[model samples]
Structures are given as C-alpha cells and as structure tokens.
Target: MTDAAAPPGEPEAAVTDGPVTERATCLLAPNPSMMTLEGTNTWVLAEPGAREVVVVDPGPLHEEHLARVAATATAGGRTVALTLLTHGHPDHAEGAERFAELTGSVVRARDAALCRGAEPLVAGELLLVDGLRLSVVPAAGHTADSVALLLPADRALLSGDTVLGRGTTVVDHPDGDLGDYLDTLRRLRATVIDDAVRVVLPGHGPVLRDPAGAIDFYLVHRAKRLAQVESAVEAGHRTPAEVVAHVYADVDRALWPVAERSVRAQLEYLTEHGLI
Candidate 1:
C-alpha cells in the first residue's frame, strides 16, 4: 500500500528512471496514481564489473516496463541472473512471470506461490550473485511476505513498501499486522544502526539518503497515528470507517479506504495489548 503524505524533511527531486548508486539503478514504471507516487520503482542491482545482475520488483504486468527492465539489466552484456520481489503485491510482482520469461531468470520471493523456478527467500539468508551480497531481511507489515534487502557493500537497504522513500506505507490489515510492523520498524532501526546503512532504495518515490532519519520519522509517525486512533476509539469511534473519518479526516478521501486498513491493524494491535 502507499501513503499520500510526503516524507517530512526530505528534499523532493524529479524521480526518473536511472542509476541511483554505483550498483543500483531505478526504472520508474509508467503507472502513476494517488497510491503509487511517481510509480513502482523497479531496481536493478549488481556489483561493479559483475557479469550477472539481480532485478528487484519487476512492477506491474505492463509489457513494455518488463521488457525495459530486462533490457536494462542485460545491458553491457550482463545477464539478468535473478528476479526478487519485496512482496507479492500486484504493483511489485505482477510482472515477475513476464520478466522472467524475457530475461530467463529465476523469480524468488518470500511467498512460495510467487516464486518461479526458485525457492522462497529465507530471512537472514545471504544472496551472493556474482560478487554482490544481498542479505534478505524479513519485513512483514505491509504484507505477510514483505522483505527488505540489505546491500552491505553499498550500505543500502532495498526497502520495499516497509519504509517508503516518500511518506509512509499502509499496513494492509488482515494480511498485515501493526504489532508486526512496529516490531519490523524497531528491528530495521537496529539494523540501520548496527549495519551502518546510509541509503534506502525504496519501492516508490525518490531515494532516501539518511536511512536512520527516515526510519525514525516513520516510527514517530506511526506512534502519533496510533495515539490518534486510540483517542478516536475512546471518543466513541466504533468502526474502522468511523476511526478513519475521525483520525484521517485530513487525509485525502481517496486514501481513506487504505487508511481504514491501517486503522483496522492499529485497532487489532490495541485490542491485543489491552490498550483500548
């Protein structure tokens, strides 16, 4: 899910499809909307001088986009060795099968159903492709199967929808849990501190330079929103819709449907912890 709010203190830039780092390039997809800011960011990652590269989040079933991702990954005579998904969201994984067909690469994801010709990703597993080392980090909040990839060499974290480049991501309730998301955020904060992550290559919007600061903002934002939800509940907001209308009245009505999902997750969290 996506957030309508822009990231606080982040400098906005023209988000285009191009290289964001020495080892990473972002191909901005064509699909843009209130949810998908700019578009889904399809990342191409490889170690410098490596003959094989990995593609992350193939994006929607847009044929041209998939073809472009394949072309970009296979440029300079390098082969697209693997396709990885941050989650099973259609915006991120819909093009996986098509892209795999175009690039002849194995598709791997946390969800077994999403994997094609490859095993599901195991948390903490090191994916050594050519010379690039990507550490699979289980990030289950946006979705049960969401994951983040850490590129130690580049000090970069490929944060799918868990930590967006701009604004925040939706905790798609039922499938997503707020408690789990909060835990994921805390874990990611520790990972950033311990691993010295400097940049975040998000699934959408622009690249984030200050990984710690971004995550801190997300944590603070979540806490504030949770408090608001709890207050709304105490103030007689009985349903998710009522909570959304009360807590997220300022947010675009177009986003309320998704916001309700977050409220549901938060309500569940509060109920489980006996906070409400």
Candidate 2:
C-alpha cells in the first residue's frame, strides 16, 4: 500500500507497513475500520546489527496479528527484547500480555496496571532495548496514561493517539483533558521543530514523514474546533448533543456519538477557561 494506493480517505504513503527508517518497521494489523483506518501499526524498533528488537503497540488479542508481529520481530533471527505500549486502549495494548507470552518479553507502559514483569514507564526515561534507544516522554492527553516514545537516532516520535498520521485525535473526556491535550500538542510541536524529527510512527494509520507539519496542522485544527465549539455554545447549543448537531454536522452521523464526547470535552475546556 504505497502512497499512490493509500485507499480513499487514507493519508499518502509510499508503503503501508515495512521498514520506515533504519531501525523502525511497522506491521499493519488485520483490524480495519473507520476508527482504525487501515489498522493498528505495530512498530518494531531495533538497533543496527542488534540481535533483539522492541515491539510497540501489539494491537488486539487476535492471535494471528500477534503471531505476525512476532514473526516480523524475528524476521532477521533477532529476539524480542521487550514490548512497549503507547496507551492502555484495547486497540493498542489489549495484546500486550499475549505478545509478551509469544516473545517471552516484558511489557512496559505508562500505567502500572499494564506492565508485566517491568516497572511502569517514567517520563523522560531512556530505554535501551538490546541497543536501540528510546525516550519515554509523557504526553498524556488523549488518555491520562497516553505517552509517546522518541528515537533520537532515527529522528522519529511514536505518537500514540495524541497525534495521528492523518486527521485529528479526540480528546476523550473524563480520562482525557482538553487542556492537557493542548499542552501536550504544544510540547510535541516544539519537540518536532527542535529535534528536527523526520518521521512519526503512530499507533494506527500510515507513518508521518513531516512531524512538524503534522503537529502544526493538529494545533490549527484544534484551535478552529475550539472556536467552532465556542460559537456553537454562544449560538445556544446548550447540551452536548445539541452542540454536536451544529459543530459536527458535516461529519458522518455514524460518528456523531463520538463527536458528542469530544463536544463535551470542548465544552468543559471552554467552561474552565471562562469562555462559556
């Protein structure tokens, strides 16, 4: 699935899943849907000439998908040194335990509950997976436990659902805070510009080549959505359902339910900031 054949509505891609950088490879999961787009991108990161690799976001509990990911890790006869999760969403970390069993690797995540035989990931912690280096940076907006991994050598960031390869990610309410999300995005944008990031390996969808540009797009998109939500509120859309009807009217109705959740989040943000 090259950029030319990226399917309708999917982001441009030279390839779907393969070697993304010198050390990164994405294995597209079998799951596909409006929410997942193509599928979850299970990333394998290994150092040059290393004998072991790190697997990220093993995706669902589907046995075949887990096996495929393990196969990809061992393609070069290297072992899986560890499994890292971006978040605890079922779509991303549900297979963590199973994948760990398949590879005999420990699972590590920002959430203590998700870790197995390993301590919870710490912000700014540098992880050495068989020789591959990864920095765990706490972004925590899409979900309170959401985190991103940075591979400095590859100039790539593994942005869970905080930033997607295409489109914008929802700031899920309750667990997800819009204010925190904005802060996270600002930090990520600065990281992209300062770190000179060239690639972004998202948990789901095709890879992103222009990290700065993508983050900028997301920032602008969020500002616009916030403005739109403010206007909807000012226009007398008093409830979440009412606001969704106005702000997300252009979106597919099937997604209106999810849109309402985001709308609720926006309303909370606005209210907290004294804008509504």
- Residues 224-273 of candidate 2: C-alpha lDDT, one tens digit per residue: 88999999888998999998889887777877877777778889999989
Which 10 successive residues of model 2 have the least lDDT summed?
1-10
> What is the TM-score of each predicted model, taking all chains together?
0.97, 0.94
Q: Which candidate tops lDDT?
A: 1
Candidate 1 regions exceeding 4 Å error are: 1-5
Residue 3 of model 1, lDDT score = 44
Instruction: Name the TM-score of candidate 2.
Output: 0.94
All models, RMSD in angstroms? 1.2, 3.5
